[model samples]
Target chain A: MKENKCCCSKKQKKLKVVNIGLQTFAESLRAQGVTVAQVNWRPPRKLDSEMKNILDDLL
Target chain B: MPVKKVTVQQNRYADSVTLMGILDAVKKSGKVMLAEVQMGTPQNVEVMRKLGFDIPATVNANDLVIALEAQTNELLDEAYKDVIDRLDRKHTDGEETFNSIDEVDPADGWNLCQISLPGEYAAEEAKKAINKGLDVFIFSDNVSIDEELQLKRLGDEKDVLVMGPDCGVGMLDGVALATMSLVREGPVGIVGASGSGAQEVACIVEKAGSGISALIGTGGRDLYPQIGGLSMIKGIKRLCEDDQTKVIVLVSKLADRAVMDKVLTFADGVKKPVVAIFLGADESLFASHKVHGTFSLEGAALKALELCGISCKDFEISDEKIKGIVDSYMKKFSPQQKYLRGVYCGGTFAEESLIYLKEHNPDSQLYFNMATKYARKLDSHLKSQCHTLVDLGSEEFTIDAPHPVFDPELRLKRFRQEAQDPETAVILLDFITAPGVHEDPISPFAKACAEAIKARGGALAVIASICGSVNDPQDIVKCGKELVDAGVILTGSNHQSTLLASAFMKALDNRK
Candidate 1:
């Protein structure tokens, strides 16, 4: 048999995940026993067009 | 007059799922007649004002607004506390949460980032993750085409994978992600643009005793002329390179003509056997290529299984069996019952059902809300025409609320409305079970179906199909049993269910 060389296939090592956005997604991964880092992500504050453009350039 | 209370938490942000959870907890308290928890976006603030709440003008999208209406001040305070407690409990669940992707430790060997944020913020976060050399699976929808192209191009340049902006289902290394079935790992790999379409194929593959190597999602618009099937090409190449994948399956609705030719030509060069199902496209397009083109999702799964040296015999229903079922249903249908109303939680299932209805019953007037050449567009999605098949998970129905898969209230109401119509003969439904969806999605509908049948004295037929594996959090066998007990006809697959509904409609027409 050929060796498993898929992008996800790394010699039988488990995948570590960084889950952003929905909390249930992290919970789902936890239930499956996969190691996960949950990120408490929220939308950035709404900015007007001019202020946003200025910040975009400055950043 | 009812007492109304409003609170705006400054500079606070919560995902839609969290806010919906808080709202559910508040409503369950039974102390308030009206309760709403939403971000203070301009549209939401306007809605709050229309509902007779005095929302301050300073409230912005970053604020968390909770509004409640109770009979007394005491009850109002209690309901408000329940919302706060639920929100606090969510925050304090002891998961060691991070603030952003930048905070994620690179030394932890994290291989992937799964994003489900709002579209406006998703692209930026995805870019950050891609820059970190982590493969991204974006579950958010509404991302602009230019953003998707830019992200895919960046992914190519970085030598990483970008799955979707609206991609909902994926399985990598036997691990299911966001709304996918828990199928065992094996030789067949899938690359799909339709969430529910891929899900149906995965569930069917598992049910037939075969398994999946991976199920890669390429968002919905990956095959458009502008996007040009970027993720799909990447997904196909990855699967082809994977030694575990022996057969590859491609599932999507019809794509742009030039893009379809390009994708098919690319597939023809791959060393592995490929099965393609472009739902509305003719099979002749695959004649010149080495790809095996199928017409239905069930056919796609069975064909993939056949390529892997496995045969599945139980997926299709015989014509004799169909005739018997149709005869039984015709006896119960009243003279006034003449149309089929398909209410579906899975968009792809609805699309497949519409295609099947068109192919089988071509003369029947078909209507849908989604874009399809087989059916005419409905004037308003809220209203269904004759022989209407509506994808309740479409954006129009989900703009203000969660998808029907997560919240069944909208679909339940639509089911009841169709049941009440005297001209409705058969109601076709598709129930999808996943990790994050409602725990017992079918029980509420099963109870409603029982009542509808009793009120009509068993004159209506409700046929349905379940899309999930036994490994899913929801018990598939139990769901099937509940549907059967409620006098609903359950089939082996969505194609079988739609075929049964088409048979019932034709038999009714013959009697007329």
Candidate 2:
């Protein structure tokens, strides 16, 4: 809890964000004049262990 | 027809939109055993697993995009194909993809990140954002206490603020975040572990003609011994040090005993004036220090305002006023109608309404289809007791459907069910407005109530309270008008609505 560790963005600078999983929250951030990049996020497919291990190594 | 399962990549649509789509697909594409569709977010996959889909615990964001359990593999495959085709068309309309947070760093000085994924995956995602150096505000509910602790501990280690997993509402620097109301910006900053409490104080501050400097949500569990009130502590420090915020307000409707004292001790350590509202219970612990603790939401707002050198009248519902409304509605109840049925979208308001009702009749028979610490739970959420409350946003209701607060469609059928009951004298509702929820929740709700009353010979008293600021997309004032137009009695706040209902019930008893 340091004095300098504050996020009152009004006293600081513009608050940019990368929004994931929820779209509306990101949109709300945008409406408030913040820069936001929304990622169309989805979990990885439920690959079987064999496929998962292969994909894990391949990636 | 054999049950077949399919998994696909999640769509970019809002969770409600995608859920509604899957349900619609199920209804239309008949002979379906099961049709649950959601992004591979850890939370959603878990839900799909509960619906008997074979989704595992280790599912990742990029893994099985969507999973479906249907009658036949052939039929479900077709359904999955059709949905993916439609969603792909919807999402790929010239959209760029970011593999991870590291790839698409927002150049606008990415200060904070808001994660609304399911709690199962929320912490992992939050850690990723924190590692990349960003403060986190999580709107996702049901995150485990251990996971929340881990996230906050990591946040502390990284000098990041982790807001909520089931965080209710929030506003920072005058911008409305997930599940929050807008207040005029001024000198005071707020840190709330409860959404409804924070919104109430903020709205009162606005009405008192004072304004807020910042409004923060420290996720509900932040005050627990395990979490150690980390987010609220951080929020207090940030607000106190910030040059813009002169007064700091802390709100939590419920918190553990050990944790409560810890918060008070911390607040006392701060120099700025603080108004602490641990509502439904009173504490005189902070009367001497720059901290002031109160019981009611209005008192908290007034105290905060008073600290800012402003005086405001309490918007309490007087006995005479409650009696007046009760007297007016007394004549409308039929001889057989003797119960008050409450259907709410917010858990806090549902409990608040129940608290007021119990105060009116301590022996009253109240039941609810919710996870409440104070009241008895109904045998079935579908069944109603004498005085019943239903939190329609419960995990059970939203497992494969949209939230009633966000989509009124799920609650539409309950109106018919309750209205048809001969004993249902009153039907109470909480209409909410914010991002992600439907635009006109009250209008359709009003229509349903009107239809039910009309069908049941107009014996029922439909009462409602709309929670949100006028700045919301579904304006409360406008929705209140719609409710009034539909012959529904609209109260000002959730607490006021409860008092009105309680008084009306008392009047009914007196008529005997």
TM-score of each model, in listed order: 0.88, 0.79
lDDT of 2 by residue, B366-470 (tens): 787865654678989888987898888877888878878767887877877887889888889887777646777877777787788778666778888776777
Q: Least lDDT summed over 10 consecutive residues: which range in candidate 2 chain A?
A: A1-10
**lDDT of candidate 1?**
0.86
> Which candidate leads in TM-score?
1
What is the per-residue lDDT of model 1 for residues B73-165, given as tens digits with 9 covering 90 to 100? 999999998888887777567766678899876566787899987788899999999888788999998789999999999988876779998
Model 2, residue B458: displacement in angstroms? 5.8
Interface C-alpha RMSD after superposing true interface residues, each candidate, one decimal: 3.6, 3.7
The backbone clash count of each candidate, in order, is 0, 21
Q: Report the lDDT of model 2 for residue B188.
A: 73
Question: Model 1, which residues run further than 4 Å from truth?
Answer: A1-13, A42-59, B1-11, B22-38, B44-56, B64-96, B369-371, B378-384, B399-402
Model 2: lDDT equals 0.73
